[model samples]
Target: MSKKKNKSKTLKNEPSSLHLFDQIYNNPHFHDIVFLIGKEETKAYGHKLVLSMNSPIWKGMFYTQEWMETKGREECLVRIPDLDPKVFLGFLEWIYTRKAKISHTTIYGIYKLAHKYCMPDLKQYCTVRFRKILNGRNCLRHAERSVIEGISKWHKISLKYLMQNSKKFMNNGKCFAGLREETVRTILEMKNLNCPEILLFRALKYWAENIQNDLIKKNKTEIYERILINPDQKKITARKLVKKYLHLIRLDLMDFKNYNELIKSGYYDHRILLKEGFNVVKKFDLKAKTKSRSGPQLSDSKILLIGWCRSGETHVNDLINSLKSGGIENVTHMDPTVSIPSLKAMQRYDAIVVRSSNVNSFYKGGNLGSNLAKYVDEGNGVIVIAINTLINNPEKQIRGKFQNQNYIPLKIAERERSEQCSLGKVFKPNHPIMRDVKTFKCKEYSHFIKTNDLNGGHIIASWDNGYPLITEKRRNDNSGIVVCLNFHPISTRITNDCGKAWLQETDGNLIFSNTLSYLIKDKLSKLAQKNPKKKIFYKK
Candidate 1:
């Protein structure tokens, strides 16, 4: 009995049997077939029996007379020039071990190989993982690739997600470039898409610019010389690239200010605008029927937040979530230490929020101030928060001086008063921004803005100490709205610089929510009047 038990235990713990799974994978000792994958022709080893048992395509390639040309060779050489070697190895690993490591980065590549080789199990595995990881950033790319690969189910799900979240994705300008024209047209034709006409137009503009940029990148010298010869060619090519899908966009649905900005955008020819009656002259005409989308209210908008909170000083995540819960669909934060989009790219958002500090590692010398000023001048909204800069930090003050100019509604004073306080007398109580915004308090008092140097701005509210609490400005030409909330807003409970835990105010969230909504409404309103007709589609 002891001898028999020892034999069973030895069989269970045998090294050769235990490591067979690993040895069969990529081991040349038993590999009878070699795969040369990708453009580089990288080699991957596999056994004919294992691959043929798993994939009918591999079975036919190895045994059928159709590939008899490869018979009698020491090792069958299969040229898989389209697949990555690592992906091919992953598929082989699955055949041996019945489990393969998959990730967001490798699922699509692996799926393509699985589909091409007719391995249903691996393809199903890829599909499950792909669906789990599908998101706004990669949905369009995935949908496009799935369509190309004839993956009807995957294409439908991805495209459906994209259409449902069109407004959020479009406003953030994620992965719109290089999509098939047909796919773009299909998205534009989606009646259920909730995006505003202005936002959709901006996304299309981004797509066209990216396409033009790629073309220029591929043939830089040639395109540059051509552009030098005919400077208008750049805009001309941009307009032509998107010409096919123009009609799908409801241009008449856009507000007058945005329509005018589009005309000045130079992405479309003047004649096209005139011919299509997209000109401002036809904006208010009764014959021009303006129809809003069926999704969220036209009040649906996006915001770009450009600022960073130092650790322990502020809670940026809490602020972002608060804004999101407050009806803003998208709030994209651009870390100043990273990259800031150009003014043209900034056009995608209805409003931009600049936190106190405005220094960037990429754009040194504080260029965002000039760009944001130009952004506001181009008929978009801006909210300059937390006064301008810390008074003690001379370096931050110098770097953030530009934020106070151009679009900022007010200039920050030289001093910052850091003391706990509450909202004082309401100067503009009936104002949209002040709606439901009662009982505001801050652990730290904000810097005062120079009232005399408001540049035609108005003080909306004041602190208990009579400092400017909330200020707003309207451009002389009616370009866009600018609101300055004059406090170091800390939305989440955290230990302050003084090492004391400060309780967060939910009112802070309401204040920002109200401010963002007010800013967006100010920009997206129709010209001179609101459309009397409200188009509602009842669900079936």
Candidate 2:
């Protein structure tokens, strides 16, 4: 029994047979297969059993009885002339150890080799690693090759992720010049792209210019002279190159000012613009509409309201109903704690109103302020209502907490003073926001924002003490219009449900509705100015 136990223990202590096979890999005496790769005739050695087991292609090539008999052990060699020597060696390492380092230079080659050899595991590993390494800085260098290989190899999903994440880096004009056509098309189709369409259009133009420049560089001196003599032909060629991408540009979404500039620059072909239904006259009409309050009426505008009014249900509900009756059809309310819509989502609405007591935490957590600023800069409108909640008491300066204060037209005071039952006077009686309404009374709690004269901000309404209670900054060349109300229209008593006893005031509600109408009307008027008029002929 003791002798039997000793024999059993010895058998259990022995290394597994697969471990022995691992030791034989790349061992010259054990290597039964040789692969000669690339033009350099680089050599890689491996065991037939190990290679065959790991790869289906290798199994079919080396394990068939006829192949084994036809190519004797001593003279047998498998040549992979398409793969790079370094890449084949990297594959060999992975086959032996189930691991290999893949760099940008070697990744393409290794991926191809892995696919050719039917090593699905290695192929998948390399594909995942390739995506991990791709980023904004390095993407421009690798985009062309990566797209070609990734598409051909059926790694489309990974490639898409890489392209989407790296697009922000393509903001550089030169970087865009190097992108493949496929890469540009794919990026433009992405619905969730963080970049504005105008930037993409500029990049596309740069790419077209580069193509023309490249054509000139490759031609004979006489051909170059001909191009210079017939510059229109060169322009035609560049236009043709960019034609495939023009439709991808969201011209409708571009601000009238920027679109006008693009048309006036004449960098692109007029014929192409006409084909896309983008006539310069139409844009001019749209611009004209902006200044004309009597331009064609627009469809009902959508407005987003954020933050709860400290005032009771009557005040909040009354304000909402007033906006609806004033022609603002759709109103969506959002909780401050919820994630704000992205800039792309914000584009759907004509105007946005943000009101929050804990506005700082809401802005920081949601990362919304910059996106909002961009939205306004793109020619949309924003209304910010500041309420001095208890949260603002400990943190005295409410203005400093605003992450996007720079975008706000009014200069907010660092400190806020509390006043009871103050009356606000109309500073700008003729202003569009106050077109229908005149003077309004403020509740017990009201805050003030100082104005910067250099910013071209207008104080449309002021407190009895001379502090600006409401300010309007019209959209200029650089940014969209912003209206800041220092005091809440709905009283805190209404928010606390105590003001329900008092009937909803018509004056305050009318002012809020007028403000909404002014923002929408202003935006539409600008749009109409750029719109081209269609001529109708009368049949006599």
User: lDDT per residue, candidate 2, 229-320, as tens digits?
Assistant: 24444344666756666777766556677676566656546677789786666555454322211211222367887555443356556556
Model 2, TM vs. native: 0.43
The candidate scoring highest on lDDT is 1
Error of 2 at 280 (Å): 9.7
Which segments of model 1 are wrong by more than 4 Å?
1-300, 312-314, 358-366, 388-406, 444-453, 496-503, 526-540
Name the candidate that leads on TM-score: 2
- Taking all chains together, each candidate's TM-score versus the true structure is 0.43, 0.43
- CA RMSD of each candidate after superposition: 21.3, 20.2
What lDDT does each candidate get? Answer: 0.66, 0.61
Residue 410 of model 1, lDDT score: 62
Candidate 1 lDDT by residue in tens digits, 1-540: 999999999987876542466667877776788888889998888877777877898788778765666465458787888776777777777777767887766777788778878888888888788888888788888877777767787876786677667767777753566676556666776655666776777777777676578665776545443232244443545677556566776765766666666668765566866686655664556445334564222224667877776652256665676566554556787776566677787888878877644342223435676677677666677887644442334444424334555455565456555566677878999987787777777544444433435646898888788777788887656667888877765553553553211235537777777787677666655223333465332220
